[model samples]
Target chain A: MDSSKVKVVTCIAPVNIAVIKYWGKSDENLIIPINDSLSGTLSMDFMCAKTTIIASPELQENTFWLNGKEQSFNNKRLTNCLQEVKRLASKSLPHLNWKFSIKSENNFPTAAGLASSAAGYACLVSALAKLYEIEDNVSFIARMGSGSACRSMYGGWVLWCKGSSPDGRDSIAKQIAPASHWPEMRVLILVVNDERKKYSSTDAMKRSVETSELLKYRANQIVPKMTKACIEAIQKKDFEIFAEITMKESNSIHAICQDTYPPCVYLNDTSHTVANAVHAYNEFKSSNKVAYTYDAGPNAVLYLLDSSVDEFMSVINYLFPPQDTAEYYKGLPLSSNQLSQDLKMALNIPVQEPGCLKYIIHTKIGEGPKILTDPQQHLL
Target chain B: MDSSKVKVVTCIAPVNIAVIKYWGKSDENLIIPINDSLSGTLSMDFMCAKTTIIASPELQENTFWLNGKEQSFNNKRLTNCLQEVKRLASKSLPHLNWKFSIKSENNFPTAAGLASSAAGYACLVSALAKLYEIEDNVSFIARMGSGSACRSMYGGWVLWCKGSSPDGRDSIAKQIAPASHWPEMRVLILVVNDERKKYSSTDAMKRSVETSELLKYRANQIVPKMTKACIEAIQKKDFEIFAEITMKESNSIHAICQDTYPPCVYLNDTSHTVANAVHAYNEFKSSNKVAYTYDAGPNAVLYLLDSSVDEFMSVINYLFPPQDTAEYYKGLPLSSNQLSQDLKMALNIPVQEPGCLKYIIHTKIGEGPKILTDPQQHLL
Candidate 1:
C-alpha cells in the first residue's frame, strides 16, 4: 500500500419502514432491541442516503459532513461505528491506519421526519466495510450506530431478530425475501405539514422503556405473533393479511408512545386523517388496498399493491388536495386517474383544505446498498 | 293515585369524567364491563342533565323528549331502563301500569362532546327511581342505559365495580369519597373547537371490545393497579400520584382506541396541545400541578388543586388564547393572572393561534343526583 495513495468508496442505502416496530432496548450500549421487528426496504431511487468515504494517510483525522454541514466527531455512535470498522479491518488490512473523510446526504427532505438516520448510518457502514474489504455481515456494527439502521442493511423484506445473547451478535437483520419476490408491492409516503418541535426518538424510546407498562406487554405478548404473521403474509403474497398486520403494528407502537409517561405524541391530525382515509378507501373497495404506518413523526408511509396505486393516488388527491397540484408528488410517475362519485360518496370523509400533505412520494420494494463504480457518483 | 292526576318527579345529575376509563364490555347485553373504572363528578351548577318524569293513567303511551325534540321510545337502552324501573315499582305500587312522559335537557351545548349521555341517563334513572320510590341503588339500571352512566350516578369520586356475576347485579357505582373529602380539588374543562364528525363512543367501544387486543391486556392487567393507586392517591390527598395515574389512564384508554381495528380517533391537534401544555406547566413547576383527561372527543378535562388553578389558568390562557376573551370562561370566577416571561420561556411551546378552544368551564367536585321538590323545575 502506497502511503501517498487514497482509497474511496461511495454507496447509497435504502430507507426501511418497519411493519413490526422496534422500540426500547435490552442493551442500550450495544443498541440491542427488546423485540424482533420487520421492515420493507424502500427503493433507493426515490428516497435514500448517499454516503462517500475517502481514506488517506496524509489526512489529519477522521472528519464527517452531513448534507452540507460539518458535524462533531465526538458523537459516541459515530465514533463506535468508525472504531468497530477499523477493528474488523485491522485483522487483515494494512491500510486500516489511514484517516478518513466522510460525506453523507439524503436525496429527500431530511426535516420531513423520514428515517434519514437509518439510511444514513446504513450507507456509512456499508461504504466503510467496502473500503476495508470486509465481506462478513456488518449490520451489527450498523446497529451500534442506530438500532433501526441494522434493518436497512438488507433489501426487500428484512427482519431484525431480538436475540437473547447479551453481546448482541445474533441481533443482525436478515432478508426474508428479495425485491423480485414481491415486485408488485408499492409504497406511498405522505409528508404532513407540521411545525412543532419533534420529540427525539432516542429520548422518547428511553422514557418509554422506563415508564410505559403497555410497551412491555406489546413486546412480550404482541410482537412475536405479529412478526410471524407478517413473515407468512409476505411469503404467501397475501396483501390483505400483510396490510392488516402492518397497520396494527404501527398503531400498537404509537399506542405505546402515548402510554409513555408525559406521552410522546407523533401522529398529528394529518396523520390521523391519512389513516382514516385509508380505512375509508379500503371499506369503499371492500378490501385492504392500503395500509399506513407512522414513525416518531406525523408523516405516513402507506403500503399497497401495484394494481391499487392509481386508484389510491386518486383517493389521496381527493382527500388531501394539494395547494399547488404541480410538484405535489415526487418519485415514480403516476398516471392521471379520476375518482368515481360512488366511491367518493362511499368514503364520506370531508375533503381536507388544500395542502394537508406537503407532498407524496411514490416508490416500491428495492435492493439494499449499492456501490457506485462510476467516480462521477462519488461525493468527495 | 287518581286516574287523571299526574305524578311528577324532577332531578338533575352531574357529569363524570373517568380517570380510569371503561372501554370494553364483558357481557354486552347486560352492560357488564370487563374492568372497574373510577371518575370525578363535576359540579351540576356548571353542567348537568335535568330530567322530569310524569306518570298518569290518562296517558296513552310512553313518550320521551330530549332538549325539546321528541325521540322514539324504541331505543333498546331506554326501553330496558324504563322496564327495569317499572318492574321494581310493580312490587310496591299499583299505579305501575300508567304510561309515562319523560323530558330531558342539558344546560351546556349538546354537541360540544361533553359526556351528555352519561349525565342524561343518570338523570333519567334517578328521576324514575325517585318517582317509583325505589330507594335501592339504581346505578345498575343507569349502567343499562349507558355503561358509563353508572359512574355519573355517584358524587365526588366514584368507582364502578366490574362485578363477577354475569347478571351484572353486583356491578354498581360506589362513592369512594364524598365531595368534602378533598375540598381543594378543582377541574377545568376546556372545550375544543373541532369540525370533524365525532365517532360515537358506543360504536367505538363495541369495536374495541371485539378487535383491540391491547384493550384486553389493559383491562386485565393495567387498570386494577391504576385503580388501586388512584384510590390511594385520592385518599391520601396525594395530588402528584393521582394526577400521574389520571393522565396515564387517559392515555391508556386512548391508546386502546387507536389499537382498535379501523381505529377511533378522538383527540385532535388542539387536544394534543392542551396535553403538552399541561405537561409543560407541571415540568415548569417541577411537580405534578395539573393533569388532563380526554373522553371520546376533543375536549380536555384538567384536574388540579385549587392553589394551582390560577397559575394553570394563566398558562391555559397563554397557550390557547380565546378569540373573544369575554365569554371564554364560564361557571366559577377566576382571578385575573398574567403569564410571566420566565414561565413562558420555560414552557417553550408555541402559543397557539386564537380560538383553539371554544371556552373553559371552571368547576369543582360536587354531590350526586338530587330530587327537586319545586314543580317549577320540572320540564313537563
Candidate 2:
C-alpha cells in the first residue's frame, strides 16, 4: 500500500424508476428480491448521486459522509457491500490495504421516494470498482447495499433477475437496452410532496413480506407476466403496452402495500389527482399518452414519449397550478400555452391553488455510471 | 281501482357496513354476487334512510323523490324491484291498481360512501311488503335494487349468501344475531369527506368485474375464507378476530379496486389518516380496540366496543380538531376532556385544522327495517 500517495476515484450514477416494482425480499441479509423487476435509468444530468472515494493508508478508519454530514459505516448492509467489492480488488494492487473515506450527495431530496439510495449505492460501487480495477459485475456488490441499486449498474432499460439459486450469485441486474436505443423516451418527475416518507422503504418492505399475502401472490403470480410484457413492449417500442403495464404494476405494488398488516399508505390526494389526470388524458385521446408510477412516497414519476411531452406537461400545469411559480417547474423547458379546455373538462380536476406540486423535473433515459475525468468535480 | 282513497306506508332502514365486502357480480342483470358478503346494520337512530310510500289512484304515474327532490323511476334496477315485489302482492290487493309515490331521505349525506342506497332500497322494500301483504322473503326483491340492500333487510349481523342456484331465489340475506345479542358493539361514522365518489359503487363494481383478474381471484379464493372467519367471529363475539378480518377485508376490497384497469380510488388522505389513527390506537393498547372499514368513499365507518369509545373519541378529537366547531362531531355523545399526551404522541398525526372531518356519528348495531308507527311521521 502507498501511504505516501492517495488513490481517489470519483463517479456519478443516475436514478432508476421501477416499472415492475420490487417489493418483498426472499432473503433479507443478501437483499434478494421476491420477484424479478424492471426499471428505466433516468438521465444523470437531470437526476443523480455523485460520490468520491479516497483510499488512504494514513486514514484512521473507514468513514462515510452524505451531503457533508459524517455517517456511520458500521451498518451490516454497507459492510457487506464493502467486503464484496474489496474481495474483487485486483491481485496486482495487493498492497491496497488502505482505509476508505467516502463522500456522497444527491441532486434530489433524500428518502423522498426518489430512489436516492439506489443512485448513491450505485455511484459508490462504480467508484470502488474503478479504484480497485475490478469490472466483472459490480451489480452484485451494489445489490448488497440496496436491492434496487443493482438496477442502477446499467443505463436505459434494466431488469433485476430474481434468481432461483440458493447462494444468490445468479441474482444480477442486466441492461435490456442502452440509453441511446430509447432516445424518444422521456420522464417528468412530479414532486407532489418533498417530505420524507413516514415509513422507510426498508421497514415497509419488511412489514409487507411478513404480513401481506397479497404481496406473496403478486410476487409469485403477477410480476412474472408483467416483467415479460414490459420487456417485450420495450423491445417492440410499443409505448401503449409499456404505459398500460407500467401503471398496472405500480398499482399492484401499492395494492400489496395497503394489504400489509397495519397497511402502508403512500399515495396522497395530490398523488391521486396526478394519476386521475393521466388516465383521463389517455381516455380523452382514446390512446395511452403517458403513465404514472409512485414509489414509497407521494411523488409521481411519469413516463411518456418525447412527442407527447408538451401537451402532457400543459395538462399537469393546468391541473396542479403551482403556488411558487419560480419553483413550479424544474424539468425540460415547457413553453407557455393554453391548456385545452376540453382536456380540463375531461380530467375534471379542480384547479388547485398554485403549489400542489412542489416542482417538476424534465429528463430522459440516461447512461450507467461514469468516471469524472475533470479532477475539479471531485467532492473530496 | 279507487281514485279518492290515499294509502301510505312509512318505514325506516339502517345502513349496513360490510365486513366481508361484495365487489363483483356473477350476473349483472340478476344482481347475483360473485362472493358472499357479511355486514353489521348501524343503528337507525344513528344512521338510516326513512322512506314513506303512498299508493293512491290519484297519481299520474310512478314517481320517486330523494331528499325532497323528485327523482326519475325509469331506472331498470328500481323497475325490477317494483315488478318483483308487485308480483308477490296478495290477491286481496288485486284491486290495488293505484299509482305509487315514494319519498326517501337519509340522516347522512347521500352518495358520500355511506351505503345510502342500501338503506334507501331496504326501506322501500319493507314499506311495499307491508302495504301489499307479501309474507315471502322480501330480501330477494331488495337484492334486485342493490345486492347490498338485501343485507339491510336483516337486523344485527347479516350475511348475503352468494347461492349456487341458477335462479337467484336461494341468494338471500339472513341474520346471524339480533342487535340485542351483542349490545356492546359500537360504530363511529367519521365523515372525512362529504364529496360524492367519482365513480359509484355500481359502476366501479361493473368495471372491476369486466377488467380485474385480481377481483376474480379474490372472489373465488380469498373471500370464502374471510366470509367463514367473519361469521365465526360474529357468532363468538370475538372483537379481535372480527376487527382483524374487517380491516383486512376492507384493504382487500380497496386492493382489487386499485387492480382494476383505470383504477377506482375511493380512500383519500383524510380517510387514510383516520385508518392510521385506528391502528395506532390499537397498537398503543397492545390489542385491537378499533377496526375501520371504508366502502366506496372517503368516509370511514369504525367498529369498536362500547368500553373503548371514550378513549378512542378523545384520540379522534385530538387528531382531527374540528374546522367548524358546529359540524365537528355527530356520533355518540363524546364528553369534553383532555386527550392523553402519550396517546397523541404515539399517533403522530398533525393536528388538522377544524373541519378535517365534517362530523362524527355515534351509533351501534341496529335492527332491520320497521314501521315508523306514528301517523304524523308519514310523509304522504
Measured by lDDT, the strongest candidate is 1
Deviation in angstroms for A101 in model 2? 2.2
lDDT by residue for model 2 over A250-354, one digit each (tens)? 888888888888889888888888898899899999999999999988889999998999898889878877677786667577675678888878887676666
The estimated TM-scores of all candidates read 0.97, 0.95
Candidate 2 chain A least-lDDT 10 residues? A191-200
Chain B TM-score per candidate, please: 0.97, 0.95
CAPRI tier of model 2:
medium
Clash list (residue pairs), candidate 1: none
Which ten-residue region of model 1 chain B has the weakest summed lDDT? B89-98
Per-residue lDDT for B1-380 in model 1, tens only?
46358888899999999999988888877799999999999999999999998899888998999999999987889988988888778475856777889999999998998889999999999999988889899999999999999999999999999999888888899999999999999999999999887888888999998888888889999999999999999999999999999999999999999888878989999999999988988988899999999999999999999999999888888888779878888989987689999999988889899878999899999999999999788887
Model 1 ranges with Cα > 4 A deviation: A1-4, B1-4, B90-92
| Candidate 2 per-residue C-alpha lDDT over B211-276 given as tens digits, one digit per residue, 9 for 90 to 100 | 777787788888999899889999999999999999999998898888888889998878888888
Q: What is the DockQ of candidate 1?
A: 0.83
Report the alpha-carbon TM-score of model 2 versus the true structure: 0.95
Residue B1 Cα positional deviation in candidate 2, in Å, after optimal superposition? 10
Please give, for residues A134-248, the per-residue lDDT of candidate 1 as tens digits. 8888998899999999999999999999888888888899999998999999999999999998899999999999999888989999999999999999999999999999999
TM-score of the first chain in candidate 2 relative to the native first chain? 0.96
